[model samples]
Target: MWSQTTDKQRNLERKKEQILTEIKAVQQLLKTEKTKERNVLSEIQDQNHKIKLSQDLIRNGQQQIALINRDVEKNQAEVAVLEKELKALKEDYAKTIVKSYKSRSSQSRIMFVLSSENFAQAYKRVQYMKQYANYRKKQGDEVREKSDALAVVIKSLEEKKVRQNVLLREAEVQKKNLEAERTKQQGLMALIQKDQRKYNDQIKKKRTETAAIDKQIQQLIREAIAEANRKAREAREAAAKAAGKKTGEKVVESSKGSNTAVFELTPEGKVVANSFKANQGRLPWPVSKGYISLRYGDQPHPVQKHLTIHNSGVEISTVVGTRARSVFQGEVLQVQVLSGNNKAVLIQHGDYITVYQNLSDVYVKKGDKVTLKQEIGVVNTNASGQTVLKFLLSHNTTIHNPQSWLSGSN
Candidate 1:
């Protein structure tokens, strides 16, 4: 549990870093936007992403400060304990020194030993004096050691205070940045609202193109599933005939649907599906470093208050040129191109299918096997300077939220 928590924290930090990288990419594009067609939507998206990132950074910084404060308090407590111990040690040592000073004379010491009742008594007295001296020396050394320890603790406390102050200041800076970015986003929203009809038209046009691309991807996946099921059926029939089973034995077929297709698997395929199901919440992310810009299911539109958008899968915003990787081992069933989404790769594991879209280049073709975390393709960076990958997971014809299947914090 502790390891999983730490991994989640690290994933959150990585996501923040990826957003920062995206902000920088947008800044560079804005600086170099000398072209005729300006992508206002890109700028708005960048600002919105940065605003969200800044808020996350502020929260992380505050948490860091709290952790540091705890350390400081702990150090302070330790210093107090050491101080008390050192003081007692010093007082004892001082008392011993004073008593020794009063009996410091060599003549006095000789008389004290001579005054013993017998030679044996005198020898014992001498031994007692030597032991007292050793005891006092040990006490003094202890006092010195404790004093050093206290000093070190004090220094550490000061350092923690300094770190806390730095974190506080950084949090304040992030808040300011967030405010500015939010204002910019609001301005963009206002501009869109000023000509709401035109903006709506743009959205409709984009939505139509996206729907067409989705249709093509769905068709490709359906065909791939059908083909795979055909092969599986053939293998099952051959095995059944060899086992002297009836020729009329029924074979499993692929279930057909509009957006998803589920293949009825053989026993081996069933095992694979069971394994994939067992790892539902422990699957690695398709992209190593990125943030979910858009999640699956219906969501309120980012700019329009009364509008809703449906996403079949989550969209991950990542750095340009980043490779899209497989979350688990599977067989590539389809690698096809779609308008605006670039290339799409669909892989099947047992009865389940995972689709990775918006790629520029694909590494595996149909029927090829892919290992866990294998690079499937390079995510395409569009003309707007945004590199986003759309990922989907399905069991049969039912879609599953990719976020729920991922291992790390969303």
Candidate 2:
């Protein structure tokens, strides 16, 4: 009886522990969904992960519940068998009591012993009495043992019933969590679609922005060229007497020899590149409070028909007046007004260059050092009122996928 009770207790504890583990996984899913708004790409992926986790949890819970159900059925069967045995034992015990108390009671037993004529017969009678007493005692003990066992079986059945209730509740909770995660996944996908439209607007804005910056860059380069010429002339005149080379001739020779190169270090571009490389998986969001639409490189448009296009940078659609922030530290290389009243700011980090295009105005200039996540410009919302930002990353001439470099999920 004691061993049976111990086994039942152990089984219940095991099933309870399994359910607890499943509940923890469901909690993580709930927490992950809250961050969906800040990072759509990450949230979408995270939702997919959460759904998988929920499914696994549900699978485990169902298995445990099924096992427990089988155990309950077995317990019921055992209880029925034990109850039948107890009924038979009670009837047999009643029959023994009737026989022991019949007319052949202790008076007859005493007379029978006295009627024995020889000592041998008397001794045999005495042995018979002792045997009958032992038999009655054994029967009484069997009845007590059977009754005690029946009580234990009844209690076990009750405990199993309680366990069944617990299992049902655990299964129900797992089912609800699974459904909730899938619904959240569908919602996230819809948001991505909405964000994609915003991203398209960002691309168009970028083209306009690049054009505007090109003009400003051309004028700046021309000024730098003029300054170079003046310095060259001064150096040439100073060296004329010593080397017997005319200023004009020396300038021509230097140009022909390809020796008229500037040795000035571009600390800004180098810094941006270094910072960008250093933060392979830790770059800030391109368009704050937005989602990535189409990533960098060739990808078919979500709504277009079998058409593919190349992307130098990613498009992020945002709410109106969303500011484009720097993903890494760099100096403002150019801020140009693009076509369609758009603008762009090019921030250089080391060898890496980040272009936040489509803006209304520029804030920083050529030599100003910007830190990581610094705001470069506000994304331009065109006449049509489309709010999108174009984000581009390039290491020298090679374009990089911002998706791969950015954080997986928020």
Candidate 3:
């Protein structure tokens, strides 16, 4: 139970550290936003994220404190038991020492052996004296061991108390910070509410624009899949002709009008796809530092609560001028320009494709083979000054939640 509690506390500490780091990142991003023309909605969302992280840090600290308290109680109990045992051992040893001292004289020991009736009785008496001496030594050793154990338990209890106090102080500080952030968030919300209609319209317009971009991305992926399949079919037909088989016509007919929902992966493509699948939940983030400001799928608007916002991918908020990197090694299949002159890079890993969008500048072109974490482009800082990378993962035309594939904390 003690070890289990320690493990749990350690895990909480690690989680607390991660939360603190994310909170710092969010604060930095907020500072950056403050320097630029403030986008109220974005600021509110960032504030909300900061508040959530602060709450998590406080909660984690509380759990750690709870675990420490548990351990402290357990250690105190153990110390008490050891103290009792050591006291009894010392008392017994003292009594034994006094009794042995009374028979300490060499003449008394000789007399004890002489009093025996026969040789066997004398031998037995000798054995008893030796055994008593050994018992006294063993008792002394046990007393020392118990003393050491009690000291250790007492020290552990003291340390746990210290840790508990530290965590309580941290929690208090976090609570104060959380309260301040909540007040700030409310003020931002009030600002939005004052112009609620205008913000709502803006949000709706943004959602519509996002929808259009998502549609274009979907169409581009579908076309890419079709083109890949067409190339594969041509390759097969050419191979058949080279082998002197009249199978080119059959090959071409077989691929006609086939739904381009899935890629016709070659052997090499299959290997890459398998490797990508194997690394699900372990892939590196496309950027070195960021947090997911908007998650995948549908979520209510941060400020306009009644409005629903659908995202085809996660929006990661990061520092401006951050270079977007590839999550895995793959061939760049396409680099298409989206609305607002923002560009999207699609890299194919077998049947799977990973998209990095909202890039301001491209670093690699089509057919370029990029290594893991290779910088593909510069992330765009929009007119509002928020630098967000819209990242998406898909198996051919079907989108998957990128968060599920990303490693560790956002």
CA-only RMSD, every prediction: 4.7, 15.6, 2.2
Question: For candidate 3, lDDT tens digit of each residue in 1-410?
Answer: 76787689788878888888899999998888888888999999999999999988888988888788778878878988998899999999999999999999999999999999999999999999999999999999999999988888888888888888998999999999999999999899889879988988889899999999999999989988887788888887778766655543433335476457999888999999999999999999999998999999998987787888899999999988999999999999889999765899999999999999999999999889999999999999976678999999999888999999999844
Candidate 3 lDDT for residue 389: 96
lDDT for model 3, please: 0.90
Model 1 residue runs over 4 Å out of place are 1-36, 208-223, 240-262
lDDT of 1 by residue, 1-410 (tens): 43664465566567657656766755554444324255666566656766766776777776667667767878888988998888889888999999999999999999999999999999999999999989988998898899889989999889879978887887888888888887878888888878889877776676677678767777776787778877776766667676654566655533543223668777888998999999988999999877677778887765665767778888887777899999988899888877645889999988888999999988899889999999999999877667789999888657788889998645
- Sort order, TM-score high to low: 3, 1, 2
Best by lDDT: 3
Higher-scoring candidate on lDDT, 1 or 2: 1
Stretches of candidate 3 off by over 4 Å are 245-259
Colliding pairs, model 3: none
| Ranking of all predicted structures according to lDDT, beginning with the best and ending with the worst | 3, 1, 2
